[model samples]
Target: MSRLLRILFLTLLLTFTACSKDDDSEDGGTPIAGNRLSTGDSARDFLSDENFDELVIEVVYVEGYRPTDAALNNLVQFIEERCHKSAGVELNVRSFPSPNIAEFNIQQVDSIEKVMRSQYNLGDKMALYVSFLDGKFEDDSDDSVVLGAAYRNTSFVIFEETLHRFSDGINEPDRFLLESTVFRHEFAHLLGLVNLGTEMQTDHLDTENGSHCNVESCLMNYRVESGINIPGMTSEENIPELDSQCLADLRANGGK
Candidate 1:
C-alpha cells in the first residue's frame, strides 16, 4: 500500500482501540461511572441508557453472631436487582468464626482499620459491619446506643436485635428492615448516591426509614431516612427507587 493509505489504516485502528469498553479499573479499581466528577450530581445525571456494570463486592460477617438468614438473602437480592450491575464481578459474602463477642467486636474494628490501611490491595471495593449487639449490652434497652455506622468507606451496621426489629409484634420492628432495603442503602453510600451526615450518627443521614421517603418507593428512601415531617415506614408507599440519574452518580464516584 502507498504511504498515505498505510497512515489512514493506522489511524482507524487507534480510534477503535481508544473507544473500547471501559473496564473501570481506575480509582483503585472501584469501577467508576463513565464520567467522574467532583461536584454533587442531580438525580438525572446518572441513570438508565448509559452502560452500567456491577462492581465486585465482598461482605464479611463476624462469625459466631446470628443475625438472620432472611437479612442475608434480602441483601443479596437487593444488589442484584437495583444497581445497574450488568454483572462484572462476584460479591463474596464471608463469615469468620469468633467465639467471644467482645473479642470479636474489637477484632472487627481492627479489621476495618486494616482494610482502610490496605485499601490499595483489596478487591470488591466495599465491606460491611453488621451486628445485633450494643457496645455495652446485648438487649433492647441499650439497642438505642447506635442504630448504624458507616465510615464513608463502605462501613456500617444493622442491629438485628434492636427493639425495632424485635419479634415483639407490638414494637412493629422498623429497624428489622427487609434485608434488600438495607443493602440497597449502604451500597448506595459507597457509590456516592447518598450522603453520610455524621460519623456514627444514624439520624444525621437522609433516610426513608419510618418516614415519607419510604412512601416514595425508591431504594434511596429507607425508613431510616425518615425526617421530622416524614412518617414511620414511609418507604412503604414509594420505595425510593433509584432511576437513571442515580446510576450516573455512581459511575462518576468510582463506586466505593
Candidate 2:
C-alpha cells in the first residue's frame, strides 16, 4: 500500500536527515531531534558559568506546520517528570510564536544567531525553534528544521514532526506515549550522546552486557518500532542516573 511505502520512505529519509518540531501554545512546548549538524569544524563558545543567571529560554512554537497542542503537552510532562525523578534537574520552559516552519532549514544557522541580538540576549542562553520535535516521526523528513547555532555550545534545538508514524492514529494513550518517548529521546541528545546508525549496524546492539542503549526497558533505547518498550513508567527508574558532568550541570544550573 501507499501508506506502507510512505513509512519506508520516511524511515530512510530520517536515517539520513535530521528533523525538528514545535508546539503552538505560549506556556508549553516539546524538544525534537534531527541529524547531527556540522557547525563547521570549529567548537562552539559557551557562556561563562557566571552568565547562567542570564540564560533565558524563549521557545518559538512553530504551529501551522506541526501537531501543536496534545502531542507537545505529553512531551512537556514526560521531560519534567523524567528529569525531576531521575536527575533532579528542573528545566524552565516557556513558549513564543513563530512564522511558518517549512521555511526554516537546518543549514540556516544565521537565523538562529538573530535570537542572540534580541533584548534578552537569548541567543547567548537559549536556542529557538518549533516545539513539535517532541519525537513524533514524520513521512516527510524535510518538512521541518531547527536552529541551534547561537546556543550550540550550551544547548541545541530539535524540530520534530507532528504525526507519529506509529501512534495508532487516534488512540490517546498510545499517542501520548509516542510523543513522550521521542521527547525523552531528543532531550537525551542535549546531554550529548550518539546513535548506532542505520538498520545494518543495529546488530551492534548489546543486549546482554547492558551496555548498548537498545535494551527494551532502557530510556536510551530507540527500538520501539519493534515493540521493545522500556520497563518503567517514571523516567527515574527507566533511565539510569545522569553522568557526573550532566548531573553537575543539572544540580548546579538546573538543566538550563
TM-score of each: 0.45, 0.41
The window of 10 residues in a row where model 2 has the poorest summed lDDT is: 6-15
**Candidate 2, 1-256: lDDT as tens digits:** 1122111111011112333233111223322221123321011111123322232333443343354355456545544432332322223344444533444443343244334222122222333222333323222344321211122222334443433443444322244454444444444443332221112122434454222254444444333322312223223233233333333333332333
State the lDDT of candidate 1 residue by residue for 77-152, as single tens digits: 5555544444443544555543244322323543443343222213322223333332322321321322333322
On a 0 to 100 scale, what is the lDDT of residue 46 in model 1? Answer: 17
Q: Candidate 1: lDDT over CA atoms?
A: 0.35
* Residue 205 displacement (Å), model 1: 9.5
TM-score of 2: 0.41
lDDT for 164 in candidate 2 is 43
- Please, what is the whole-model Cα lDDT of each candidate in the order they appear? 0.35, 0.32
